[model samples]
Target: MTGIKSIILAGGSGTRLWPLSREMYPKQFLKFGNTSLFQETVLRCLEVSDISEIFVVTNEVQKFFVIGQIKEMGHSIPPENVLIEPEGKNTLPAIFFGMTEIEKKFGNSVVGIFSSDHVLDLTAMETISAAESLASDFLVTFGIVPVFPHTGYGYIKTSEACGPGYRVSEFREKPDFETAEKYIKEGCLWNSGMFLFETGLFFEEVQKYAPSIFTSFENGGDINEIYANVEKVSIDYGIMEKSDRVAVVILEQKWSDLGNFAAIYDEFEKDSVGNVVYECDPLLLNSDGNLVYSKCGKIVSLIDVKDMVIVDTSDALLICPKSSSQKVKEIVTELKDRGDERAYMGQTVYRPWGSYTLLEVSPEHKIKNITVLPDHKLSLQLHYHRSEHWVIVKGMACVEVNGQQFFLRPGESTFIRAGERHRLSNPGKVPLEIIEVQLGELVDEADIVRFDDVYGRN
Candidate 1:
């Protein structure tokens, strides 16, 4: 594992788990307990690689989540290792970007590409480490031994035995129930979407199979320009399915992608009545085989409900049968077609500085409970159409209005007229809390005009 590095893909919108997962805040950032799926993936990567050796590929919106969550774990990755894509061009480009970056600094090493949102037992890392020897010549993928006929995942058919794995004979798409059963009977393994690639061999395959994508990255232009030109394709479609040097390492450890609510229900611990309850204690009279998740911590009661998926967030509630959970992405599409912001964001949005919770909103006025982390500051910005009044509820605040700086204690207040540049900072050791009320004809996030930002926003 000396020359090995890890690449974590963290840019998926995760629409299937929506109402809990949003475009800006996806399932990888959601906490299952104290740790999120993204953090769990990072910890798993740490078993074989050091923090500095782990590279995370994410987009602009999720860059902070990647940095913030790593900080929460009492560790930090190299700032450059957190590669931010100008725009997502799917897994092929993302993985290529990570491989290119690793080659630049560390030079043609063995890289493990992993998904940010997956559940896996730690024993899987040992198998991953053992696959490095085969990775030198083959594009190695971990194939989970199918426990049942799972139609949700693609199947990998192995032809013959190779070094610590088998030669990949065929890659099957996600099949129908009957086809999935047939494949399982024929000893096909689930395609795990995780790969161990030697940089030299991976680049060679990419150059041969996906020459357009290879040329775009090989030209060495700006990342934004490169992403703009490259086609949107997955690694499976671009390279793995076309390459002849593919190998499948059978992973015997427990694994789940948790692609939908049904998959989540399968992973969670169920009650005696086969009900999975999260975040709140629920009263159920005759609820069997139901997954109830309430982030609002409200009392939920279900009577005679069976095999239902109930997700209650601060902004939306989703109720669908467990069998129909795969259709949740259709609901997200409808919301997007209707131009609903709820499809992209939740009531509570995370920022680089901290987080803000939307308390109330209307045509003329909007209110938010804003929390700034200790020693953090908001950008020096102004609103052309909105006037804001901020009242500090906790900690110390350093307020700057049009370059005149002043300090405000708890219970103190300040006002900024429309078009006046202002900024807020938390100078105390504790988090600064404030209630911000905006008055304007246009009360939206698009109204802000940032003059200077430390986090590099335009």
Candidate 2:
């Protein structure tokens, strides 16, 4: 049996699902239910391959999230197998990076490539296995049979049947509503952005169509430099469209890219009035179709509103018509152009040790609720422009400041002056929670100077 491995491409910033999905934390890491979409992808891949055989490709910023999520699942990827890209070139480069590593480890094996942010039905594993088995000479891609004429997705025109799959006649770009309906009438499939192929054959096709990309990897140069220099193009554009040996297996399972609030509404459970609410109790009177997501647990009351998307975070609130939800990216673009911190600053930021939630921020002071996992410690670090006061809220915290070590229980407090080296560790069996208050002239992540870090964040 040829060894099969799954390469999960999880580096996308997913700007389309903004506010909820920030640049630092993307949509794949967002929790729709108890688990995130990335965790679901991990579970899906495990059905087809072992944890050791699974390789994940992510950017440097997202590397810790990937590690934390995998650890939460009680599985581990070999540190070397978690290929980190210095920069996200696009899917082709990211997939190529993971595929190259898999080839080196298990030559010419069957590889299943999956996007980390898609919501898939139960038959995903079976469909992927079918695609992999049929990918001897052809690059196999999974195509979803469109339930409706969706103009948001690219369409795949299926030609003559080739074994269990169909030859991809042409790849159509995102069309207008009229063209989308026409494609649906003519039996087109939505490109699922999933692929299965043999290592050697896939590279051969890549060499033929995308010669520069193949040569960059073939020459054995610095991987990051190669990615930096290569054209930032998707795999569908770079190779799948041009390659003669391309096939798409029709997937008979529910699937959604969840590109917008409207799409997200479809995956969630709805009330009698067709309103979907998340994390908050929402009362809808005369409201027909509304999607509400509030992380702050504020009671949302809607009146006489239909087809609306209401997302309320701690720092931001978005209310827009569901029809124009796709234009939310424009807001993200505007925020980035204006250099607004809300565009990229997530309410809860995850670190290697655990995570922290931003409680408040003002001119002279900042507050955070920090949670450190059991047996984990932050870096031995100091700030140049700020001093920190830590109040233990839960569990036991082993604090170190200027070579002095002491344990602080709940309701206990400690202060570290500016330029003083300190470390906070959770010595207890449970999670350590602390309220951190910073008082200073300037306070931000850039002020930190780490002398020693267990996770190597210097």
Candidate 3:
């Protein structure tokens, strides 16, 4: 058997799952349990493959989220293997980059490309092994048996069963409920986005069918050049739908691409009224089949509201019917049009070293409750337009302002003038909590000039 390499694609803005899953930090990083979807996805391959064989491809902004998640799980891959794309350009280019990298490092191995945001059954090792063994010239993807007539997922029609898979006859787009029921009756499977293929064979298909893809990548330049020019097409559109030698492995197991909150509600254990509520201290009267998540810790009781979604974060609230989940993207679109920051950034913002939850913000100033991880440090940088005041509220801090280095304890503070180099870090056993107040000409996030960074920002 060829040594397996897993390419985990952890890119994409899950705007459909807004209020919780923002543009900067999407659904992949959202936690269902102790582990995130991405972390669970990373750990999924380790059952049949080695830890060193796993390779994650994420953007520069969310790469640290990946690292932090893995660290929390205590299952670490080499940092070199965690390839960061300069920007996201859909799945094909990301997979191609990982395929090329796997070939360079491990030599034409079978690479399993899995999306980070999905939840799949892990007990089907036999099906996966069979697909891996049979992946000679075809890209083998797991097609799930449809439980309900869902229009969100694509369909795959197959011919005779071969080993654990069937030769794919055709790929169909998402259909209406009637068509979907017809598909289930016609022995069609839900196109589960998981794919297994040989790296060399995949490259051959790409070179043959997607020559423009190869040309856009230009014989694999740097990651920036690749992401900058690669056509924004998914694996289904770019390769799987167009490929002649695609195979579909029938996975008779529960699978979910939790693309939005509706799918999330389906996976959850519902209450007596068939409601899936998280974070909202619920006292329900007549709410049934609804998914409501609240970050504000308020009582959410309603009357006669059935099959709806109510997501209330600290800064925003989204309420829509279950049928209108697909239209949530339009809300995000309008927010962007109106320069609404809530669409992209949530109340909480992520950094390479740590994360800051926005308590408040205004024109001349912004207030944040910052949490820095132990042994983690932010970029040694200075703001061009803003100066910052840091007050240590919880743990000890290692502060550097201008040319001075000092230690700040609880209730102690420090300030950095505009254009003066400064860095805040936690060099303690506990998490450092600081109340940061930024006063500036303009407190925009883009006013930073990094001199040194621990997470390869240079």
Candidate 4:
């Protein structure tokens, strides 16, 4: 795998798994057993290639998350290898950006593109390797054999059998139930969106067909300007469907996109009564065919409930039947229209140093429980319309207010008035916990004016 590099696309909002997955923290970061879906993709890629040869393409906001999760998995990736797109221009531009980087380093080599949130069998690496071998002539894509009629996925119809793969006859969009069943009957496979491409050849096709995208990256202009000028489209519509040398390799194992709750329920472990329960225990009298998750540690008791998906977070709860789980994104759309904070953030917010949870919030006052990792510190900043009082509840904290430094222990406290520069530092071996009470007219994150920050935020 010397000339091969793995490109993981991880810039999806994943609104279908709402309440647990928000715009900032999506489903890829949510834990299942002991590992998350994104972490699982990294581990799987490491099995086939070296860590130094792997690349991740995410947005500006998700760059910190990618770094934190990779470090938490005990792997260190080069900062240059973690490419951050200015804004998401869909898969075509994202893949084009990553492919351009790979071309600079490895020349005309093989690259495997994968989605970070998909579930794949551990044995699928052999199929991936087989696809990589065919990358020199054809743009290779993996197709999963359909066990049933799945209308959520697009179909890849095979025209003729090639060596270890098949020549793609057509790329079909998501079909209705009748059309999906017809595709299944005709031996079509679900398009996995995973690809193996020879870097130079792929770019050559892009230049031939989608010349604007190719020229934008090739001209060495500003990325943000290039993205704004490029078209918002998927690779399937822009390249794969139009290319003559497209190939498909069949994956003979279990796989799922996990796009909605019904797909999750199908892949998740169920009880004898066909129920998927997570975290909190559920007492059910006659519940069957239900997927229940309670993240707040609250016991959920149900009587005679069946075929329902119940998800309870700190701020929101969703209950819908399994058949209607695909419509969950509509709820997210409604939230965005209504200007709800739950549309973008969860109860606990993560940062590069540590995390903070909203304890209470009101128009005039807001309270938060902040945790700082060992040897971590906050930015040197000041607020425009808010003052903050910090009470150290655990560990030691080094405080700096208006350029004056002082140390505080457990049960100690400090205050900084509005327009005064302040910073918080954890100087102890253990994690530092503080209770922060903010007061003023505007008490929000947008009020901060950062002078210096280690995490490089503006």
Q: How many clashing residue pairs appear in each of the predictions shown? A: 0, 0, 0, 0
Tell how far residue 123 is off in model 4, in angstroms: 2.0
Query: Model 3 scores what on Cα lDDT?
Result: 0.85
Q: Write the per-residue lDDT of candidate 1 for residues 273-370, one digit (tens) a residue.
A: 89999998799997899999997979999999999999998889999999999999999999999999999999999999999999999999999999
| Candidate 4, 79-120: lDDT as tens digits | 888988888889999999888888787777799998999999
lDDT of 2 by residue, 93-118 (tens): 88888889998998888999999999
lDDT of 3 by residue, 351-423 (tens): 8677899888889999999999899999899888888888899999999887788999999988888989888
**What lDDT does each candidate get?**
0.94, 0.89, 0.85, 0.90
- How many clashes in candidate 1? 0
What lDDT would candidate 4 get against the real structure?
A: 0.90
Report the lDDT of model 1 for residue 17.
98
Q: Model 1: residues >4 Å from true position, as ranges?
A: none
Misplaced by over 4 Å in model 3 are none
Off by over 4 Å in 4: none
Model 2 residue 391 CA deviation in Å? 0.7
What are the runs in model 2 whose C-alpha is more than 4 Å off? Answer: none
